[model samples]
Structure formats: structure tokens, C-alpha cells
Target: MSTTSVSISQKLTLSGSSSCNPRLAQAPWEFDAMPGYGPGSSEADPVPAHAPTNAEARPGQLPQLYRELPEEDLHERIRAAKEALGEDLVILGHFYQRDEIVQHADFLGDSFQLANAALTKPEARYIVFCGVHFMAETADILSSPEQSVILPNLAAGCSMADMADEDSVEAAWEEICEVYGVDPQNVTPDDDGKLPILPVTYMNSSAALKAFCGRHGGIVCTSSNAETVLEWAFERARRVLFFPDQHLGRNTAKAMGVPLEQMPMWNPRRPLGGNTAEDLQQAKVLLWHGFCSVHRRFSVAQIEKARSEHPGVKVIVHPESPMPVVDAADASGSTDAIRKFVAASSPGDVIAIGTEINMVNRLAAEYPDRTIFCLDPVICPCSTMYRIHPGYLAWVLEDLVQGRVNNQIVVPETVAAHARVALDRMLAAKPK
Candidate 1:
């Protein structure tokens, strides 16, 4: 029987967090455990024999005791459970996670980095990912079959991922196939050895999409390796169709000297995805109509403000931000790249970052010697990332200590088998 992919809890609400709010800014552990994003939404067939056998058994409420505990007690509880579990448990914290959650992380980095980190610890049976849904799903995909990946809070879902669902993309593919008068099922190469279009999905997408790419001879890409991934795709196909984040696709392709006119945004709502027949014929990259709300919030105005306020300020932005914001900054990269840029700077450098609030704040705390701050003066963490409160971490860990696997994220073998193919292609694209 097929179980839906990981539930989309954060999809229910944008986010109840605000950096401006004193309570939310503090260590507030209390939260609602919203569940399910419809059935059979973003996954595949039969459960993996090696995956958590009790896939049907998942987390429910946030346990009143966890919600009621003071910040110190909550942290102490997590530490105690972590100590009790020992090598059997490994906590992976996304860079966007709150400081409270980060403190308990055995491994800390971006999602792709964290997934690779899981492989380093073969002895750890439980991977508690203090990140969002897609991240936990990735850990499940890459980790040992005997291991289980868990998300502390079920509601921590990425809004950008939700933008490109499986069904809509399938529909788009069929339409594109009709335009090229080629079979969508099999992308045969021409005499020049280039296919009509090659699909390239951002790592932020659902596992179902990754499987789609694998089945159709496409590949996956993390933000850090988009350029390399694109180069790989171009070598195989005449053009590309990038999904779930138009900004990333646009910015990366633009840097590679792909003209703006040749990169058309695909709007699922319109016929031919809002492109004329000629646009599709001339298209080099068909960017999906999707984006990250947090990155999209950044604008050219914010960079200008930072420059005026801090003399000789060095600016850097994530490519997920709109093209204008990326253009205004001195450099554009993935989460890891942004961190490295700051690390390499002189101690006295005034660095203004355009990304999530929690990450920027964490960096500020890390490098007290440098003048580091977020470009957006208004405090707002990524709505979804903030869903992972410390309360949930304490609850899940304690439950694991009790021999109960709550919030277990299990990807079906059918899905993981195909998704891994696409993920492997991404790994191969890494710079040597």
C-alpha cells in the first residue's frame, strides 16, 4: 500500500513567528502539531522493506508537558535524552534553524550537507532532523535503510516546495512534449546528440519530482551546484526546464550568459505556460513559476539601505532571491557559499547578508568581531523554518528514549530507488 510522502503541516499556516514579537523572539516552545497535506500527494508506491516498518505509526499532539516546560527544563530534557540515546541518535540542524534547536544538533549545516553528514555516522539508527519536511525526507533517502529519519516538528514544511506539485508538473511536461513534437516518455538525442529538453529540479522539490527526473534521464541540483548542474544538463539537451524556484533558475542561467529573452517563466495557469510557440522554440531555460517567500522578500531597496547605513559594507545574497537583489549584491550563492564568504572576510568587514533571519542572527553571534547583520531591518525568520521549536525536539527525543518512534519520516522504496538516481547525478556534478 502507498503512504503519502511526508505530510505538509507548515502548509496550513504561513508562519505564526515574527522576530519583532518579543515572545516569538524568545524561547517559546509551545506550538500546535498540525498534520497531513491530503493523501497520496507527493510520493510513490510500496513501502521499503528496510524503511521504518511502522511507517503508519507517527506523531500526534505536542505533549502538554513539553509545551508547559520552561526553556531551561526543555533544553535539559533534550540533553538528557540525547545523552541517554548516545551514538544511536544524531541530530541534523539546518542553518536556518533556531539557535535553541542548533544547540542540540550533532551536525549543523544546510539540508544537502546535513544529508551527506548522515552517511558519516553509520551507527546512528535515528536521525532527528531539526529542519523542515523536505530535508527530513532527503535524510531518509540517503541514510542507511536500517536507519530512521525524523522531523522534530511535522509542521515545518518548505513553502517553495509546495509551489511545484507532482500533478501540475506532469501536465506541463505533456504540453511541452506536444510543442516539440517529441515523445515525453523517451527523450531521444538528435544527430547533434542533444535532446529537446532536459528536466532539472532544485533540491527543494518533492521526492516524486526527483523520481520523475530519474525516470526521464534528468537530475537533481542543490543551490550550491546549480551552475555545474546546468552545465551538465546543457551538454545532454538542447534546452532545460528548471523547477520550483524561478529566481534560482533565472539568476544562475543569466550568469552563464543565457539571454533573458530565451529564459521564459512557465505559469501553469496559462496556456503554453504563458509563452507563445515561438518563445518555447527559442527557450534555453523554462523556469517554473515558483519561489521562496523568505528570499523573495529581499529587494534592491534593502541592499541600498545597508550600503547607506554602513559605510563600505560588503553585500552578498542567496541566488534564490530575485535577480534584482542578486544584481545589487557583490556575490550570490547558496547557504554554504554565503557562510564561506563571511568566514573569509577580514574581521573588521561590515557584511550585510540577504537570507533567513535565524541564519544571519546565528552568524552575527558567531562572529562578534565583525559587523554582521541582515539587510532586512524588519525581523522575520523564514515562516516555515521557524516552525521547528525546541519543545518538539524535547518531545521526540524523550519518546525515542521510551522506544517509540514519533514523527518517523519514511520514503517508500519505490520512491527512494528512483530519487537516489537523480541525487547521485547531483553528487557527480560537484566541483572536483
Candidate 2:
């Protein structure tokens, strides 16, 4: 399939939730429970080994309590749960989460920052992550063995991260190795102290992929430091194979003067990624066929509309956006970076942002003096991120209050060891 076709299909899959509001999808604790029980329902159910127990709603039906509970009541319960747990619990919220959930966060930042934040609070027994599934896994990999990480909703998963599975990536690696005549078991360095190619994975990927990078002399990168990581890779390798985000790799490499002709998209299903041997040999960066659904919704037309309607409007977008959108914007960075850009602006400055709706709305509310709005006015949130509702937050925190560990995310020791190496390398890499 073409890149556009792939993006559309993934968008449909990512947004496929039973509830009209994705956030109302059944929580893991709701499943198999008695029908009359609500959010604080203590009634036990026989949880299946493979199925999620927190899921409360019947197939195609939304949870009654989550839908009916007043916002004030939810807040009160969440507060009571947190106060009961005290310092024993540390809630980390990503900027993309809804304001209701973020208001209860002990630490609010991007994924990489939150992972480091998890390490700082070693005293906390539970780390409740108000983010997607992969983020909870990263926390599990980084936190101490004694500390348990919890993702409020088990259904919360990243579409972009799911695009590049381990099997497909391994297959691609083998094909590239054959093309370059390099051995994974025993790689030989060139005269310039560089290997043939290095794998660089974005932090948005799975922990297994991070381990893959660690084993292959590769490193992990976040949007804020992608350029630095790529520079580090190029110094030690002839070319780089970046996974789980084609736009980021392409935009970052292009900014460093790497031409588009030298960056080939790798569709794992296609033979040799649909490239000739000569093309593969000449490539500077092999980009995996993946993209962020939320970021992909942004368009150059939105930028134009913002400019036309609001004169002197400053447009800022996430680097995960398409190249055209990023190029059109005045600035592009991570979610935190976009927040910083808006924060630094003068009062009365109109700013248009291209990112998740929850964050944009929160920023607009935070900086009332400045006119802030999302470029896509249709309210498109990261479907996975939105799965984390305040109701789920209350449920998990209350579980801790009851001296039970519910929905704890634990990365296997063997996988965690390798994943940590790549994460450490990312933390050590200095910005260019």
C-alpha cells in the first residue's frame, strides 16, 4: 500500500472504539463484574487469564458509572484515594492527557521526562502512568523492581508504535544485512570507526525494539533530541535505520542536509522495502512506514487558514506532523516544546498549534492572555491517550488504597536489561 493508504487504514484502526467518546471504553476492572456495580464497585469477578478484568461494559455498551458520575464526584473520589496513598503513589501525566486527569498528576511532562521522573520517586510503591501502554512499559523497564507501574486503561495503545512489530523489523534487518554483506554476530568497523548501518528507534516504540537497538549498537531518541541522536548515529555508522516514525526521521535527516533521494521508506511487506539494491546501498536513512495519527491530521491548509483568519498568527506544530505542515509552521518540536513556545509568547499573541486537542485546550485555558487554539478545530485527540479517563485514574488509585495491585505493568528482566542500555544512551546523548 502507498503511504497515504497506510496512514488512512491505521487511522481507522486506531479510532475503532465501541464508545463514541473513546475515553468511555470499558476499564479493565469493569469486566465480569456485577452489572449494578459502579466505579468504586468492590464486587469481584472471575477474571480470565487472557482477557482484561477491568473492562466493565458489555460488548458495544458504555459503562454506566463512568458516564453518569459528576465531574465533582469523580474529583472528590480521586482526591480521597490519593490522600490515602500519600507519597506511596506517584502519578505521572503526559501533556496529551485530558485536563481532568492532568490536574491530579504529581509530575507532568513528555514520555522521556516522565520515565526519568519515575526513577526519582523510588520511595513510591506505585507509579500510575496517565499515558498509553508503551509509556507504562517504559516506566516498568526504568523503575526499580519494587516499584510497580500502572496504566489506567489497558486498551490505551499507540497506533504508530504498533505499526512496526518485532517480527517485521527483524525481517527488514536481515534483508539489509544481506544487502550490505554485514554480519550481525560479528560487525567489522570501517577505517573511519563506523559500522555499515545503525538502527535508531524513537522512544514511541515498544521496549522490545529498544532492546533490539541496544543489541545492535543502536540508540533510542525522543522528538526533542532526535537531531542529536541522528548525529550520534551518523558519526559511528555509515547510515541509520529509524523505526516507528518516518516523518521524524525524514524531517530530522533533511534538516541535517540529507537529501530526500537518500531516504527510502521501508514497507516491511514489500520485497526489499520496494527499493532496488542500488537505492538501498545509496540510502542515508531507512525510514519505517509509520506515523502518528493525531499529528497526521494536521495539514498545510490549516496553517493557511490560521494565517488568513488571524493576522500575525504564529503556527507551531509537533515534529511528528507531515513535512509540509512542519515546514509551513514557524516552529516545530515535542509537545513540551510546543507548550514552551506558547508560554514564551507575548500576551495577545495568537498562536495556532497542531497536536492533540486536550493539550491545546489546556494550554489555551492556562494562558488566557494569549490566544491559543488547535489548528484542527474538529477536536482530534490521540485516541489511545484519550483512553485514560479520570474514572480509570480513580479506579487505579483506589485499588492502591485497598492494598491491591491492579493493572501493574512489568517488563521482563531480560528485556528490561537490553532496553535500559538504549535508554541510557539516549539520556547520555547531548543536544547538537
Relative to the true structure, how large is the alpha-carbon lDDT of every model? 0.79, 0.79
Worst 10 residues of 2 by lDDT: 37-46
Highest-TM-score candidate: 1
Residues 328-399 of candidate 2: C-alpha lDDT, one tens digit per residue: 999999887888898899999999999877788789889999899888744456656765667777777777
- lDDT for 211 in candidate 1 is 84
**TM-score of each candidate structure, all chains considered together:** 0.88, 0.86
Q: Write the per-residue lDDT of candidate 1 for residues 256-328, one digit (tens) a residue.
A: 9999999999998799999998899999999999887668768899999899988899999999999999999
Off-target runs (Cα >4 Å) in candidate 2 are 1-68, 430-432
Residue 326 in candidate 1, Cα distance off native in Å: 0.5
